[model samples]
Target: MSTPVVLIHGMWCTGGDWKRVRDLLEPRGYRCHAPTLPAHEPTADQPLRVGDRSLREYRDFLEQYIREQDFRTPPILVGHSMGALLAQQLAARIPVFAAVLLTPAAPWGINAAGLANLAPFARVLGRWGFWNRPYKFSREAAAAYVYNGLSPERQKACYERMVHESGRVAYEIGLWWADWGKTTSVDADAVRCPVYVVSCGADRLTPAFAVRRVAGLYPQATHRHYPDRGHWVIDDEETEEMIHGICGWLRPLEQRAARGQQAPR
Candidate 1:
């Protein structure tokens, strides 16, 4: 049987963000699932419904979604940015085959703050009550940072798919220490699955420095970097190369499972 892979996207994005990834992985016999997070539905020009919703909501929705699938084997969890942090938390709470965190946002207690990382959020953070409302990055901010690796046309196309995110969730991630809920906390030691954490060299929001620290949380994590790609990875023409690289890493694990041998912890 094919291995199941659940692809989780981050803030300001829905399951649709994994189109490139799904298109590639499904043909290769992996069952890929990309579920939109709660409150990230397209509300176009309307007051955002993500009002004051916490990250815990997203985590609960995904955990339930994964359980309902009932795969013969635990699915591999692949997450990007904030979703990466969610994947890490889920790995600790559930049975997972493995996890691939792409340009992951730092989990609770890790400070990825530097000029490079914080610059992208400078304007977004300027707004009063930003911590209590829904927010989306301005096109200018996104083009300059999130989708910086893409051409103008590609960037424009990707930008069209952007969605509003919960300000409460953002605040939780940015100031995790102050969060009484500890929503972003991950018990790295509880995640026994093999982990692959990738970082984009030019990514301003979640830079390599923070990604490296996230990787260190897992004892068996393999760290890789794409010097050319940033957060808008799937939108870039070279996305196939990166997806193929990730598939290459997953294939051996799939093979071992097929033979009834568990991959190393």
Candidate 2:
């Protein structure tokens, strides 16, 4: 059996958002699992309560799924934005082979990327009850922030796939300082696995500077900063290079594990 790869997506998107990455991984001796957040599905089967979920709850969902699968080896955890934070938490708690965090949302040390910072650019996301109601940033807001680099047509298309995110989860991320739950704090010391982090210079939602701090937290992390790219790293174009990079990084590790009879899949 090949190593499993869990593809975790950011806010306002479902597992389908990882399509570009998944398509590339499956053909390369890897099995991909992309689980949609609760009530964040394109066509949600359950009642919509996304706004009611906390950061811990989101991480728990990913953890539960992993435990149920009971993979032969610790799966590679790949995540973006909010999903990135979840991946970090999972690695801290479980036995993960590796993690690829793409513009991961801030946990504790970084406050610049919080939802509070988006208040001026996107008021709705930071409005009252943001931590207690379902919310999805408007396309206008996206154009001003996360979706800035894309053309108008492309931006529109990406916006269409957007969905409501958990307000409580937002609270845990942005207002983590006030949270007694300690939801967004990642135990860096507990993450005993290889870590790869990406930060886009053009990204405003998760500032590259703060993301750099994320890489620094790890003992020796692999981080690539793309000055030209925006938060949408897996855009329809100019993505093959990064994807190839990720593939190349994992190949040697997988080969070594296989050679040692560890399988790593």
Candidate 3:
């Protein structure tokens, strides 16, 4: 049987974001599933409380989902940015084939210096609940935050589809324990699954350097670098090529593992 693929979304995004990736993977005989986060809905009006959520919450959610489904083999957990960090945590505990960390956030934590440089007022807005205020979506700001590398038309459409994220989560990202430092507190060396990271050349939020840094942690893992792609590398014009590259990298490893499992009993 083919191994399952589980796609996890980054902060401020949902499983729907994986639709395109899923469409591309299914034809290859890989069954994919993307689960929604708690307190997040496409049309919800309620505010998400920070105290009610954590990376641990997401880890447990995925664990339970896997148990309930009784997946025969471990799933290949593909995570983007924040979701990548969560995927690492899950792989550390569960049996997983591999992790494709796409433009992943730093496993240590977001750089305090970098955060300060990009959004100097983030702390202030976080503390005062300014981010929680109901303001109409601004295409300009949304593009500035996520799609700086995309065209104006694409940016406009992306902004319309973007959902309102909890200010608490953004604030928590800056906090010490709230980030990967806390999540990876349990020795990262304990994580046994091979991890493959794909780095985009120009991702401002989760830069290529961040992806390179994790290499030392996963000495046995592989890393692929691409030029000029933004954080949304999967959505870029060269997306089909990128997906093929990923599949090429993954298919051989999977075939090797299958052969080993079936070897003379």
Say which candidate scores most in TM-score. Answer: 1
The global C-alpha lDDT for each of the candidates, from Candidate 1 onward, is 0.86, 0.81, 0.68
Model 1 off-target regions past 4 Å? 45-47
Per-residue lDDT for 121-227 in model 3, tens only? Answer: 35335555543432222465556556768898988766666665555444445454545446433346766777788887766667677678765567766788887
Candidate 3 Cα RMSD (Å): 3.7
Which has the better lDDT: candidate 2, or candidate 3? 2
lDDT of 2 by residue, 57-172 (tens): 77888999999999999899999988898999999999998999998887775665545346633555547766778777777887667677889998998898888877777777
lDDT of 3 at 197: 85
1 or 2, which is superior by TM-score?
A: 1
Candidate number achieving the greatest lDDT relative to the actual structure: 1
Error of 3 at 150 (Å): 1.8
Q: Which stretches of candidate 3 lie over 4 Å from their true place?
A: 46-52, 109-117, 120-126, 129-138, 177-181, 184-186, 261-265
